[model samples]
Target: MGGKVVFKEYDPDQLTFLPYKLEELVPQGHPVRIVSKVVDQVDVKPINRKYKGGGASSFHPRLMLKLLIYGYLTNTYSSRKLEEQAQQNVHFMWLLGMKKPDHNTINRFRSEKLSGVLKQFFSQIVQLLVAEGIVSLKEAVFTDGTKIESAANRYTFVWGKSIKHNKEKIKSQLDELWKYAQTLAGEERLDTSPTTFTEVNAERVKQTIASINAALAEQEDVDPKVKQKLKYAQKHWTENLKKYDQQEKLLGERNSYSKTDPDATFMRMKEDHMLNGQLKPAYNLQISTQEQFILNYSLHQTSTDYQTLPSHIDGYEALYDTLPKAVVADAGYGSDENYCILEQKGIEAYIKYNIFDKEQKEGIKDFSNDSLHYNQQENYLTCPMGQRMQHIGDGQRITTSGYVQIVSRYQAANCHNCPMRGVCHRSAGNRVVEINHSLRKHKQAAKERLNTDQGIKYRKRRPADVEPVFAQLKHNHGFRRFLLKGMSKTEVEIGLLSIAHNLRKWKA
Candidate 1:
C-alpha cells in the first residue's frame, strides 16, 4: 500500500440548513413553468360553475387544470402517473405547490369536472395566442383528420351486418317452424294468434315461438327434429334478438361499434403492423390549425374524413362565433356537401377533388366522364364516339345528413362495333353515365380556386401547418391512444392536449 492516501467524504444521512425552495429548483424557461404561467392567466369560471357547494372542500379547478395540462405536456397521460409526479418530480412539485392530490381526485377532476367546460378553457388559450398575434382566424384554417385508437378492447365489436344476418336466420327458421306447425291440428293454432314474422322483433319472435310450442304440444306423431329446432329457438333466438336490439341502439348510425367503448367505431387503421387489412376501434380526430397551432378540434364517430368536415367546421364556428376566411384540406374532405357548406359560409375552399392531381397528368382525362363534351344549352353530352347522349333519367340522392343531390343519368346511343368501345366502355350495354350538375359546378369552381397562386401557397402550407402538430402529438408526445372511455371524456382529454400544445408553443 502506498503511504499518505487521502479519501473524500461520503454521507448517506446528513442534514445541514433545511431550506428547499421549489421556485428556485425549477429553471426560468422550463416548460412546466410556462404551463403554470399560461393556465394562471385563463379563467376557470366555466369549470367552477360545474361544482356544487360544500362537498368536502375540493381542490381548485385552476390547480387541477394546471396539473393536467402540464401532465399532458410531458407525455404523462395516466392520472396515477401525474399523482406520482406531483409527489416526486420537482417540476410537478413546483407547479402543484407541494399539494399531492391522489389519482382519484385527478381522474375525477379530468373526467367529471372538466367534461364540457374544457373546450372553453382551450378556446381561451387559443384566444390568448390570437391576442398576441401568433395566430389569426382570418388566415387559412388547414383541416385534417387522423384516426386514433380508442381506449377499448379491439375484439369486442358488433357489426350491423352480423346482426341483420342473425335476424334473417331466425326469420327463415321461424318460417320453417310455422309450416311444420300448420300440419298439426288446426284448432291448436287458435290458442295464440300467429305473430307476423315479416318484420321480426323480440316480442314477435317470442309470440311466434309460443304458438309453435302450443301447436306441437299435443301432436304425438311430431318429428323430434322439429321439436329440437323449436326448443333451440325458444332457448336462444328471443334473447339473441333482445341483445341485437340493444346493440342496434348503441350503433345508431355507425356500421360497427366496440362493446367495450360503444362510441368507438371499427375503422381500417393505417398503423396495421401486419398489413393484413385489420380494422380497429378508433375515433376520427379532426383539427383545424394555423401556423402549426390547433385552432379547433373535434372528435367524430364517423370513420370517413369527408363526412367529418362540415361538423368540424360547425364546431369551429361554435367556438369562435365566426368562420375562418379560407379552408385548405386534402382530397379526403372533398365532397359536395362540404363544398356547399363552405360556400354557404362564404369561405374560399381550396379543397382538392379525389382526381384533382391524377386528372391533370397527360392522357389521364381521355375517354373519362369529365372529358365528355357537354353542350350547356342542349344539356346533352357528346361521347368519345361523337354520339350525342341524351338524359335518360333523373333521381334524387339523400345523403346521410339529408343533403339532396339530384343525379341525372345519361346513356350513349350505342357502343356496338366501335374501335374505342373496348377501352371506352366495359359493360355489355351502352355507356351510361350519371352526373350531378350542382356537384360538377361546385367542383369546377373549386378547381379554379385551387389553381390560383394563393391556393398553391396554401397547398404547400397545409401539410406543414397541420401535420407536424399531429406528428409531435403522436410521435414525440406519445398521445396515440386516448386515456378516457366515452366520447365526452375523451373529448375533454383532447381539449387538455390542445391547451398544453398551445401553451408549449407559446412559450417556445
Candidate 2:
C-alpha cells in the first residue's frame, strides 16, 4: 500500500484577507533589510536641494536612491526591469513602501538629478563603512584597472594616427593645387609663407580658397583644369577639414575616442566567445580596494593602468582628506613616472615593473647580458662574451610628463668577430644600448621594497583584497557593459554599483 499523501489546498477566489505588514514580510539579517537601514542613515540633504518647490509631486529623492541601490544589489540594472520588479518583487515593494515608480522616472532621476551628486553619496557610504570598522583607511590599498565597454558605437572610432595621416595627404594635395593655381595666374597669388602642412587647419584652408577665388575673379579666360580643381576643393576638402578640426579638439591627449561618446576612448577589449581581439569603446575604471570593499574609484580615458595611478591617488585624497600609507599593485601600474609621483607623495610603493617576472626565470638570469652587469664605479657594462662595453656618451630624454631623464649610452667594444655575437646580438656592428639612470635607480629601490617582509605580506593580500570585487561586479552582478553614454552618467552607474557592493559586503 502507498503511503498516505497530504496536499495543501489553494483557492484563488478566497475572500479572507489577513492583515499584511510589509516590514513583517522581510526577515531580519536580510540583504534588503540591511540596504534599507543603510540608506536610512545616509544624509540626502544635498540631493534634496536640487528640486525646486513648485511642480507636480514626485517620488522622494531618498526613496529613489534607496530603490536604485536595492535594484543594483539585486542585479537589476535596467530601469525597465527595476520598474517591473518594483511592481512585482516583494523586497523592492517593501523598500519602496509599495510606491511603484515607472521606468522613465527612475531613468530621469539617475541621469538628470543624480548625475553630479553621486560622488557625495558614494563618499558617505564609504565613511559609514569606516565608522563601522569594515574598512581601514590606514591599511594598504590594492589598486587595479579594467576596461568597461561604453555604450557608444564601436565602429565610429577616430584614431589620432589616421587623422594625422589623412590630414597630411589632404594638405599635400592642397599644396599642389595651390601651386597649380599660381602657375595658371602666372604669379604667387596665395600666401606662400614657410608654414608646415601641420599648421594647415580649416581656417587656413578657407583663406586659401578665398585667395584662389579672388585671383580667378579678374581673369576672363581661366584654365579648365584650374577651375575644375577649385570646384573639387570647395566641394570635398572644406567639410573634411572642418571635421578634422573638431576631432582634434576632442582628442587633446588621447589616442582615440568614439564619436557617440566623445569622452570614451577606443581600447582593446578582452575577446568575446569567438576569441578575437575586438577594439571597443571603453573607459578605464581604476579602483582601490581593501578587504574586498571598494574604497575609491576613478574613471579615465587612458587605456593603460600606469597613467591612471596619479589621478586615482589624487581622487582618493580628495575623498578621504588623506592618502593610503602604502599602495600595492601589479606590474601594469609600475612606471618611472608613477614611482616618482609615489615617492613625492610619501606613499610606500610595492609595485612591479615590466621585466620583474622575466628576470626571475633561470634561463634569462644566466644569460649574463650587458644590461645585467653594470659596474657603477668603472661606468662600463660586461657583455655575454666577456667584452667590456664602455659608456660612450650621456644624453637627456624628456618623458611624456615633462621630467628630464638622464640616459647613458653603452656600446660594445667590438662584436664583429665575437664568438657569442649571434646569441647576444644579431647586429653586424657593435651593439648600442641606452639606459636611463633615473629609471634604474627607481627600479632598484622598488625591487628592494618588494623583497621585504611587509612587502611580501602586501603582495600576498593584494589579489585577495581587490580581484574579487571585480569578479563580483562582472560575474556575479552581470554588469559587463555600461548602460549609460557619457562619462558623467557612467560614473553615476559605477557609483551605484560600488554602493551596492559595499552594502552587500556589510550584510555578509
Candidate 3:
C-alpha cells in the first residue's frame, strides 16, 4: 500500500439526531430553485376552479404542476419515473415537500386536470418571461416546424390515397356485380336505387349490405352464380368498403393518419437512420422563437410548414392579444396567400419564395429565360435570342388552398430555326410561359425586404434562435416521442416542456 490512504470519514449506521431541512439541501441558483420560484408565482386559480368539492382530498394543483414541470425539465417524462424520483431523489423530495404522489395520481393530474389549462399556463410563463425582460413580443420571431413521433403504433397507418384508390375499385366491382344480378333475374328484380358513392362511410356501407341482403332474401329461386356473387359482395366488399370509409374519415383533409392516435398524421420523419423515406406517425410541432426562447408553439396535422404559418400566428395573437411586428421564416413558408396575410396584418414578412435560394447562383440566372425583359405596355417578353415572345391568352391557376392565380401566357415567336434552341427552348412548339403578375409583385417585394440589413440580421439569427430549443428538447431532454396520445394531451405535454425550457433560460 503506497502511503496508507487516510479516510476523513466513513459512517454507514451513524445517524444525526438533528432534524434536516429540505430547503437547506438544495443550493442557490440551481434550476430546481428557479422551477420552484416560477411555479410559486403562477396563478393557479383557473386550475383550482376545475376541482369539484366532492371527492377525497387531492394533491394541490400548484404542487403537482411544479413536480410535473420539474420532472419534464429533468427528462423524467414517465409517470412511474416521476413517482420513483419523488420517493428517492432529494431534489424531487425537496420540491414535493416530502409528499409522494403515486404514478396514478401524477398521471391523472397530467391527463385530466392539466388537459385544457396548459395553454393558459404556457401563456402565463411567457408573460413572466416578458416581464423579466428576457424576451419581447414585438421583436421578430423565427418560425419552424419539426415532426415528433406520436405514441401511436407505426403499423396502424391509414393513407388517404390508398383509401381513394380502393374505394374506386370497390365501386367498379359493385357495379359489375349488380349488373350481373339484374341480368340473372332477367326482369330487373334487384333494386335500381342509385347509391351515392361520393361519401362512402361505414354507415352507408352497412345500409348497402342490408339492402342487398333483403333483395336476395326476396328472391324465391335465385341462380347459384347470382347467389354466390351476392354473398361474395356481402363478405369481401363490405369489409373493404368499411375500412376505406374509416380511413377516409380519419384522413379528412390530411394525407394520412394513425388508427390508434387519429389526430397524428403519418409523415416522413427525419429520424430515418437508413436514409430511406420511411413514414412514421408524427405531429407537426410548429414553434416560434425569439432570442433562443420559445415564444409560442402549435401542433398541426399537416406536415408542410406553409399551411401552419397562418394558424401559428393566430395562436400567438390569441396568447398575447397581438401579433409580432415582424415574422421571419424559411422558403417553405413562402406562398402568395401567406404573403398576402402578412401584408394585410401589417407585419413585415422576411420570408423567402421557392426560387429565392436558386436565384442566388450566377449560372442559373444566365439560363433562366423567365428573368428576361418583359414589356408590360406591349404585354410580351424578349427571349435570350433577341426573339419577341408574343403574348398569348391569360389562364387561371388554382392553388392548393383554392386561391385562383391569373397568369398571362406568353410564347416565343419562333424556335424552329434558332441557333440557341437547345440552350433555350427544347419544346417542339414555341416556348410557352405563364406569368402571374400579382405573385411576381409579391416575390419582388419580398426579395427587396430580404436584402435589407434588418432582414439579413433576422435570417442570421433564425437558426440560432429556434433550432437550439429543438435540440434541447429532443436531444438534451429526450423528448423525441410524446408520452400522451391525442392532440390535446400532446399539446399539454409540450406546454410543460416549453415552460421548463423558458425556466431554464431564465435560470441561465
Candidate 4:
C-alpha cells in the first residue's frame, strides 16, 4: 500500500481506452506467411497489366494469383467456390487483400494469361527459391510423365480394327456384286440392244441397285463401339456410291472417325486392358522435380514416356541454365534416343530401360548387381553363349561399348559348308556377331556412379523421390484429367499444376 493504490469502476457498456500495440492478426510463422513472403519477391507488375484498364477496379493480380494457388493447394479449383471463399473465409480474405474478385475474372485470368503470365510467374518463383538455397541442382531430380484425361467423354474412340474390318467387308461384297453383274452382262450380249438383255437386264439391274443400296446403307450397322466408324462409313458410302445400279462404278474408300473428341487416340501401354476404361484425347503431363519442387512442366501428345525425355530436358535446361546432375525416370523414358540426348547434353541420367525384360525385372534377384556382365556405361550383357549383346546400341557396326562388332562376311560358299553352322552360324553365310570392350568415357562415368556409394545411393533415390510426386498430383491435386484442349492449352494447364506443386513444396 506504500507504493501505489488504484481504484477503478468497471462498466460493461462504458467505453474505455487501453494501451496496446496494433499488430497483424495473422501469424508471421504460418505457412501462408511463408508462401506470401516467397511470392512477394515475384515481379507481377508486367503480367498484372494484362488484366488492367478495367473500370470495375478489379482485384490485385498478385493477390488473385496467390489465392488461386491457395485454391489449388486446397483442391478448390471451382471459380465460384473461390469467389465465395474470398468473401467469407478469413485466410482467403487476408491472402487476397479482402478483394472479392468475381468468378468470371478468376476464370478469364487462368484461361487467358495462364500460358504466358502464369508460366513466367512459376519460373520466377523457382528462380527465387533456387537463389534462396532451398533447392540444390547438384542433388538429384526425377522426371516423369503422367496421363491427364481430357474433359471429353470416352465414347468417342475410333478403333483401327473396326474401321479396317468394315471397309474390307464392304469392298469384298462390292467386288463380288460387280463381278457377277459384269459376267451376266457379257453373257447376254447386252452391248448391242436393250431388248437383247432386257429380259434379264431389268431384274438384274433392280437386284444390283437394291444390293448396292443395302451395302451403302449398311454403314448404319457399323460398330457402335467404334466412335467415328459410322460417320466415316456414311460419308464414304454417300459420296462414292456412284449410281445404285452402276455396281461397276462402286469404289471403296477407307476412312476413320472420332465421336467424342476427334483428336483423341487409342493409347496402348503394353496389353489392351491396362488403360482399358473410357478415355479421351489426353495430354502427357511432363514435370521436372528438383529437390521436391516441380520447376517446369510441359504437355505433349506423346503416348509413351520415351518421347518426353528430349523435350523435358530441353525445356528444363532452357528455364534453369543447366541440366540436372542426375535425371531419374521410370523405365518408360529409357530409350536409345533419350540416352543419346542426355549424353549430348552432358547430363547424367538414371532412367531404367527395363520395360519389356530389356532390363532385369524388379525383384528378379537383381542379378545385375552380382553379374560381371553389368557394364554401367556400356549397358551391355554377357550372354550365356559368351556373346556380348548390345544393351545400348549405337545403331551402327560400332557398339556403344567402344568395341567394334566384326562380322565375317564369308561368302555363301564358305558359311554353307561350315560344320558348326547350326551352333555358331544359323544363316546360309557366315554370320557376324557383336564384340564389346569398355570405352574410356563410359567406364569413367559408370565407375563414378555404380562403383561408389554416393552414386548408387542417389540412383536408388530416384524411385522414392519422384514416384510420390506423381502420386500426389494424381490423388490430391485432381491432375488425373486435363481441363483444357489442344497441346498449347494443355501445356498451360500442366504448367499451372507444376507451379501449384512447387508452391506447395516451398510452403511445406
Which candidate gets the maximum lDDT versus the true structure?
1
* Residue ranges of candidate 4 with Cα displaced over 4 Å: 1-25, 45-57, 160-281, 355-454, 476-479
**Which TM-score value belongs to model 2?**
0.91
lDDT of 3 by residue, 15-39 (tens): 9898789888899988988899888
Give the per-residue lDDT of model 2 (tens digit) for 1-508. 9999998998878775776788888888989888888889888888888888988998999899999999999899999999999999889999999999999999999998898888888988999989988888877899998889999987898999998887898788777766666776756555664333545777777778777777677777888877787788778787887898889899988889999999999988763644688789999999999889999999998898998999999999988898899999999988888998999998999998888767656324544342558889999987776788899999997755566778899998778877766667776689887887667888888888988998889888998889889989988889989999998999999999999999998888
TM-score of each: 0.95, 0.91, 0.91, 0.64
Cα shift from native, residue 323, model 1 (Å): 0.5
RMSD in angstroms, candidate 3? Answer: 2.9
Q: What's the C-alpha lDDT at position 497 in model 4?
A: 66
Query: In candidate 1, how many clashes are counted?
Result: 0
Between the candidate structures 2 and 3, which one is better when assessed by lDDT? 2
lDDT of 1 at 25: 92
True-vs-predicted CA distance for residue 75, candidate 4, Å: 1.6
In candidate 4, the residue pairs with backbone N, CA or C atoms under 3 Å apart (3 or more residues apart, or in different chains) clash, namely: 156-260, 228-257
lDDT of 4 by residue, 53-121 (tens): 747676666777787777776777778998998898777777877678889988877777565656777
What shift in Å separates residue 440 of candidate 1 from its native position after superposition? 1.4
Q: Worst 10-residue stretch by lDDT in candidate 1?
A: 187-196
- Count of steric clashes across candidates, in order: 0, 0, 0, 2
Model 3 reaches what TM-score against the true structure?
A: 0.91
Q: What lDDT score is found at residue 304 in candidate 3?
A: 87
